[model samples]
Target: MPQLILSPWFFILVVSWVIFLTIIPSKVMNFYFNNEPETASTHKPKTHAWDWTWH
Candidate 1:
């Protein structure tokens, strides 16, 4: 294996992909499925404003 293959960023990318594929689907599906029956949604959306300092 190449030295770059063992880097922290690579590990983070792989871990993120694994979690995205294995875990995120069920959670997202459950959210939509649980909300399907409701005429009024119980979940509230948060207002997110970007800080110029981060940019």
Candidate 2:
């Protein structure tokens, strides 16, 4: 197993990467929530009509 040396810059890079990764999911979830509500109404008929309890 190869061990990489830890340094100040390496810690900074790791922290930056972690922050970047977190931001991506946040933006994706934001976009998802923003778009889903608009499209959700269209699907409601299909989803609701299929269920007997709804009628």
Candidate 3:
């Protein structure tokens, strides 16, 4: 059987594709599924921004 020589460009291309498919999607999903609801729920609060000054 022939062997596939892994060049530097091939490594870079694979790493980029992995990051594109995996990391970006997880971040987007986390934001959409987790953070979106938290932010949306807190958005309607009557609290003022100055509330943090007491802390």
Candidate 4:
């Protein structure tokens, strides 16, 4: 309307979507809640659940 609300590419596309919602969703949720939480890869058995049973 009023020159597209005083353009300049509409205030640089609203400050680039407000810095893409304030910097990429808090750095992707702080690296997905700072990892190491899937039972630390199944209570550490060769990194991801192993230790079979048979003998």
Candidate 5:
């Protein structure tokens, strides 16, 4: 138990989890909130019925 807690691997695992919990959520939220909303102007034009005919 004491040896397991004192091991370098355990320390690394603890640090990695701390970074993951602390950094990942903020990054995800920033991307979610700061992302641009899609607009009509950016939409592709609708294809006409005849547009699919071989030219």
Candidate 6:
């Protein structure tokens, strides 16, 4: 019904779903990907000097 579609609760529900779809997936992916355990070997050694010469 048009009345149901225009109701405040329906509006709130739609907004909630939009927020969930837009926000939750990125947060979940970040949580899983960013929270991975890191090992020292996984890091690249820092270069102390920059080589200005082009090879």
lDDT of the candidates, in the order given: 0.81, 0.69, 0.73, 0.75, 0.80, 0.80
Model 6 Cα lDDT, one tens digit per residue, 1-55: 7665657887898999999999998888766455668666876877787788977
Model 5: lDDT of residue 11: 81
Q: Write the per-residue lDDT of candidate 3 for residues 1-55, one digit (tens) a residue.
A: 2346667768989999999999999888765444344434555657655556656
The per-residue C-alpha lDDT of model 4 at residue 43 equals 58
Candidate No. with top lDDT: 1
Candidate 5 to truth, TM: 0.44
Residue 36, candidate 5: alpha-carbon lDDT: 75
lDDT by residue (1-55, candidate 1, tens digit) is: 5666668888898999999999999888766444456487898999998789955
What is the Cα-based TM-score of model 3?
Answer: 0.43
Candidate 2 lDDT tens digits, 1-55: 2346567668899999998899878877665444344433544444433657756
TM-score versus the correct structure, for each prediction:
0.44, 0.37, 0.43, 0.27, 0.44, 0.43
**What lDDT would candidate 3 get against the real structure?**
0.73
Residue-pair clash count for candidate 2? 0
Residue 50, model 1, lDDT? 78
List the candidate 3 regions with Cα displacement exceeding 4 Å. Answer: 1-6, 32-55
Score residue 51 of candidate 5 by CA lDDT: 66
In the range 14-53, model 4's lDDT, one tens digit per residue, is 9999989999888877764544655344554455676777
Task: Show model 2 residue runs off by greater than 4 Å.
Answer: 1-6, 31-55
How close to the true structure is residue 36 of candidate 3, measured as C-alpha lDDT?
43
Instruction: Assess the local accuracy of residue 20 in candidate 3 as a C-alpha lDDT between 0 and 100.
Output: 100
> Which residue segments of model 6 deviate by more than 4 Å?
1-6, 32-55
Candidate 4 backbone collisions, by pair: none
